[model samples]
Target chain A: MNQDWTVIDGLQYSAWSREIFEQMHEGGLTCVHVTIAYHENTRETLTRIGEWNQRFESMPELIRPVYEPSDIALAKAEGRIGIIFGAQNCSPIEDEIRLVEVMRRLGLMIMQLTYNNQSLLACGCYEDEDSGLTRFGKQVIKEMNRVGMVIDMSHSAERSTLEAIDYSERPVIVSHANPSHFHPALRNKSNKVIDAIAANEGILGFSLYPFHLKNGPKCTLDDFCDMVVWTAERMGIDRIGLGSDLCQSQPTTVLEWMRNGRWSKTMDYGEGSSSNSGWPDSLSWFGDNRDFPGIADALSKRGFSDGELSQIMGGNWVSLLNRAATPASPFLQHP
Target chain B: MNQDWTVIDGLQYSAWSREIFEQMHEGGLTCVHVTIAYHENTRETLTRIGEWNQRFESMPELIRPVYEPSDIALAKAEGRIGIIFGAQNCSPIEDEIRLVEVMRRLGLMIMQLTYNNQSLLACGCYEDEDSGLTRFGKQVIKEMNRVGMVIDMSHSAERSTLEAIDYSERPVIVSHANPSHFHPALRNKSNKVIDAIAANEGILGFSLYPFHLKNGPKCTLDDFCDMVVWTAERMGIDRIGLGSDLCQSQPTTVLEWMRNGRWSKTMDYGEGSSSNSGWPDSLSWFGDNRDFPGIADALSKRGFSDGELSQIMGGNWVSLLNRAATPASPFLQHP
Candidate 1:
């Protein structure tokens, strides 16, 4: 195995234009999870999946949608970069119960239940309360399981998230979350949830979302390295991986949407008027100073062995996804 | 009191479109939730919202977004219909926690945490085991609380939803759900969840999701009314309301999304996915068809008073939203 692994970003919202893809390639991003919608650009908010797909047909090699659980592996085996067209928001599925099948066919593997506020499935960490999953949400979970979609509760509400962890037949993933146990906030997972997911055969993607870091924008590779180390001790190397919510190309209407609960129609911000939500100042730039590329260097600097670093980068996510795809997943229960 | 009470559908995503909305207006639908995302037509969604708002904006006397919790009252007082913009999916919020407040400020209220699958905050009910809420999901809830956004856990995972109910400082809402006791499925709420939400001063908007009903398309308003009655008896009048996901203008695409886990990457239909997730096959339409609108007439016909009708129609949701909007709600334990 190559000591210098070609890493896959667990989650990202950077523009998928050819130029940006090129930048990602330059940055050694072998795979990337592209976010499709938030509240700002919901399925009803936009009108062009067909158009988007047609565009993808133009660049089959550079970027395309992944449907099969094996597609990621196929891409890797073929020595090509992989792209997972994921929805940061569930708005695209709209009200259809069966759309999960269509999405899985379309190659959407990881999914976050609630972006910021409440949805049909569950509450957002940004929701007024951490009420667990809703009645309809439970049905949704079953469907995802039936289709082998990895359940991601990264941006979900605490109540709903813990509920999801317990509810999933397989171990659930946090795809992109920090540990509040490390950096206290609504965006990070608790130590209890982290360990619980691990015990259940789920994976946790350590995110470089600066907001959850103990040191905000001023944070350095050292701080990031420390996070990986902290998580390693808690969740072990096998259940950890990379999930970078890299929102490169700011000033794109997306940020405004993101700033305004683009993920859901819920945020903790008051209901008065439009204003900037407080974020960690001096954070790493997605295309420029990502600070941690796939977390390989950071983990190594933190003294992780090559074996551990491999798992933190992508192996863990792949293993979890593959397990979820297995036929026996249906019988999985909390261990 | 004009016994011909004006009515508005809370949340629905049927084969909606220009023709459907017209049917709704002709059918005495003062206003409808008009799901924008379920159909995969965001542009058309805005077109519908704009058209509806334009048609009724000036007729603010006839149609308007239920801005304030009391806006429903205002709509009722003015002999107008009310439209509440709620997302079956929090896809719009994307990943920004602050956007929840932004969406609320934009007059978007009643956001769900996830759509049919897992999202950032919590897991959907369709999930296999049902982990509650994620840590980030917890933050999303707190933010939604500070901003006075109502938590709707209709589609959330059971554990996450319960956690949200327990964590919320404000009353939450299961905008549309059936009781599992009446019919077991991820679409229906359990006795424990139903009772807990109410005990916390929340409300359950009994849905006419059609799929959630005990009967199929052959069911009538009487069956719908019975579900409402069942809900009232089990939960209490104060916590009951009309969430009748009375979708009309929704398109087949919307239906398709509902059929599959549209927003979710896979079909997360939970236990019901294989056996239909336990949602009742028989669907009842709104109005006298399902004997839904006739609920009041039937109740009155059955010797129930007007007070109860008022409570079921809009009073319950109104009160719950009001409590949620309260800066110092008596129900809140955290704040």
Candidate 2:
């Protein structure tokens, strides 16, 4: 593996600390999109952003905010990891379409239309029926496009994902999910959804989370690389990248909060059943930010050319951000 | 006196009930701009709006929501009182400019830039050093203009009110503040603020709260009418109307919440001193919504023409709403 190669993780919601920042540097990560909100409303999201602001202030040598696609290159040049803010649910906007521009201006570059239940915008994957894009959902997609905020559908239901691809003028990304062909997890995407994303010039970020991988925590690095190669064949190499969905250093309680937010009073196991209602054991091959080079080595050993390996690792994500994150309207530019 | 006068109160924060709704009808009020939020954040403001939704559902015969200026006329024609929502503080939006449009779309017709203290947007009257408009306040002024939410500067500091009037494209309003020329209360507007509002084609909704009136609760009806006549002389008659600032049937605790909403540890007297901390005694001439007719009668007895009396009663407010509440952008119109 090349030492100077740029690596990017599409999603992470870690119990972040200086140790994690050092590990990201050790892994040769140029950029990482981090979840700042799960089910937070607008003010709570602002507080989360304030926390990130403090993090950037305290660790200027380790990480900086990624306000645009160019910021990733800047971070790479500065030898620091660029942090892109994203929300895993529409709760941050709180049923307001106009908040899309506001959040984008505040440096929130990506937002999911739903989590794992019926949201005001769309139905989530765990719901009984998929209602597709709602009235406000369609409006918000338009606003997000105008404001240069990428629409993410990682936790959305199948119909909503397809409808989002159809409705969005800009590319829509599933920031963290694997192909259901690899592992039939509820959070994984179907071939139809993956194909639609590819058709719309969107990217599918392959997740390394144990629950979404074949054989769970016991899945081999070779099997993961093989799945990636298969996905690249179906949807062009430019349409696939690493997401990882690494929830590093997070306790089981964080997993429970992610699954149950404020919507459920009783316990909701989500991907885990009653017997398995906690964070899964970390994969031995790819555990934390320090393990990216191992995955790169595995992909290279599987006969992927250096260029193909670079695209899979980070170049495709940079390209996706450039293609989708530029503001469509000059009015959206801050004065 | 005509039986079908189109009466309007610029501001009220009553313990709203079906009985109060009936009193509005009995007073021949076509519309009232009611305070829906004071120091409430976005979620709490939404709950307040939801409560109003329930009220509308329960009392369809007595009151209805006024979405546009035309709705006031409709209410008058249908013999129902129209409710126009306003927020006395910037807390409802909570540092997000996009919420100005969202709150407007959710039937919030007006918003004060601040409420008796320095806010994220601007400085309130009670703040010793008025910083005027902050960076967020300038952006919010533009957003409020685009969305047609009337910028109310009644409780804002002098410089902030002047700056808001200058900045807003549409007519600004002091929805509930007496001129300091009448009585020098901390919440009252100065002549410069009043004149700026009038110069910008705005209207000043003269407050009838006892603390804002000369001689407090002992202020005579003739004296109140004389102040109105004097103010109409300083600013044009077209730029003056009644705001009442009536807070009927509310407990003293509600006043405390308004004065020090989670912002202070100790009690803040606001307009009231420590001795008279509770709500000032209701004025004899204007006790509740039912006393609006008495005010009109007093103005009529002061030798004002019937046309001028009609304008002061409600016609000016309807005109002001039509001038300021129409969305500047066609995109802001709901589909």
Candidate 3:
């Protein structure tokens, strides 16, 4: 693995501690997008940001906040990991579109419109009817574009995500979802979704979550790398990167909360028929933050050139964020 | 008309003026539920309340705020109209269920879970699919019950309304919708909804909005009184009252805001095929605040006894509010 590569994981919601921060540093992760809100409102989200401020004050050696694209380089230069904030659901804005800028100013770089349930903004993957981007959803997308917040369609329904890709002025991203062509999971995106993202010059970060893999926890490194190569050949290597939907050291209750916020009382076993309510086991090749090197090694053995492998590892996401995280007042053109 | 009766209109969104207050006083209205929010959020709703505070300060002789059922009597004694604030949608509370108690404390006596669109709480009448009360909706209903904030299902879908009526420990109210059996408007309730309210010892407020009437603006007062008599026969007279969804002296754009808000860019000419996106003509006889006497006179001509007419006019709503507006800490069971 090249130590100088800007290895940025597009999404992660691991239970954070000094140990995980140390692991991120050891894995040569220059930046990581972390989930801040699952089902929290504006005030509650503000409190969470306040807690992050305290953490930043306390953990200067291992981590720092990433509000701008340049912050990743700053973190790398300082020998620390840049922790970028993102939201798994749009509940934080709580029906007000104006809060899109507020969240952006508060260090949110990415936001998913829905998380496995229908939100005011967009239909979730689990909703029976995908009415596409709602009236409010359109308005929010416009505001999110104006604020330069990356729209993540990882958990949105097919119609909603497709419509959002068409409706948004900026390029959208499937921030942390696998291709349905490989796994056919409920949360996975179909080839049509990938084609639309590729057409729109958007990025797709492949998920390392076990349920998204073809063989779940027992998925081999070779098979995983092969899938990546297949996706790259189909969608272009410039549009692919690692999201690694890792959930290290978190309890089962967090998974329950992630799948079933206050929006559902009954446990919604989101994907298949097994009814396993807890988090699925991590894949053997990528169990923790420290396992990125193993994936890089596997990709190298799969005959990807050093430059193409670098793009897949992190350079592609860095390029996407360089265009996304800037203020929308004077936005740069797509590469 | 009997002057001794406590006449309370279940719903109104009048363009507030001293002249309307004078008409309310002249019509012998003791209290009127004035809509303070349609799509406004918590902060905007608080500003509206603050504006009402100023109105109360400046027009003490004309109108006073009604925080409880007893305030109706106080306004009657003072020869002023009692103005009770209510929200037409749950947008004011947003996603935080705890705001239920806060709104109640701020003199919001009634709140509709949905206003012609799907909300975080429940499905509105306009949504294609009605999944019933959401998980958050159920929790908010419980909090509303505990705080004695009346749940108004006027704009909710059938399944959501029925579920709310069944789930609520406190009696729910269809605060401003007519029976769909009489007029099959999208906003009207069916016999099943009316029966549920009647069975729960709740109240049904027959709307006087032209769109809700049998023949729009041309509906005869005799026909209106006949519908009332028919509804009273099905859901006992004790469970029925006048809501009269009046939009007196409001401009056409105000109606646009009420129906569309920031939710839609295109004008949603709701409930009809006609492109007349404005306030429809008020019914022939009942046009404004001064027309309550005409309704009473017409009902009298239709052979309503004095006690029954009085109940239809306002007594039933007063009784309903007496149970609804009090804090649940010391609630009295209904007969």
C-alpha TM-scores of all predictions: 0.47, 0.58, 0.51
Clashing pairs in 2: none
Q: Which candidate tops TM-score?
A: 2
lDDT of 1 at A271: 17
Q: Which regions of candidate 1 are displaced past 4 Å?
A: A1-6, A40-48, A51-55, A259-294, A325-335, B1-335
DockQ of 1: 0.02
Which residues of candidate 3, in runs, are more than 4 Å off?
A272-275, A330-335, B1-335
Instruction: Estimate, for each residue in B168-252, the C-alpha lDDT of model 2 and write its tens digit.
Output: 8899999988888889888888888888988999999988889998999998888888889988998899999999999999999
| Share of reference contacts kept by candidate 3 | 0.00
User: What docking class should model 3 receive?
Assistant: incorrect
The window of 10 residues in a row where model 1 chain B has the poorest summed lDDT is B326-335
Higher-lDDT candidate among 2 and 3? Answer: 2
Best by lDDT: 2
Q: Report the CA-based lDDT of candidate 3 relative to the real structure.
A: 0.84
Residue B329 in candidate 1, Cα distance off native in Å = 61
Better of 1 and 3 by lDDT: 3
Model 1 chain A weakest 10-residue run by lDDT: A326-335
What's the lDDT of the predicted structure labeled candidate 2? 0.86
lDDT: worst 10-residue window of model 2 chain B: B326-335
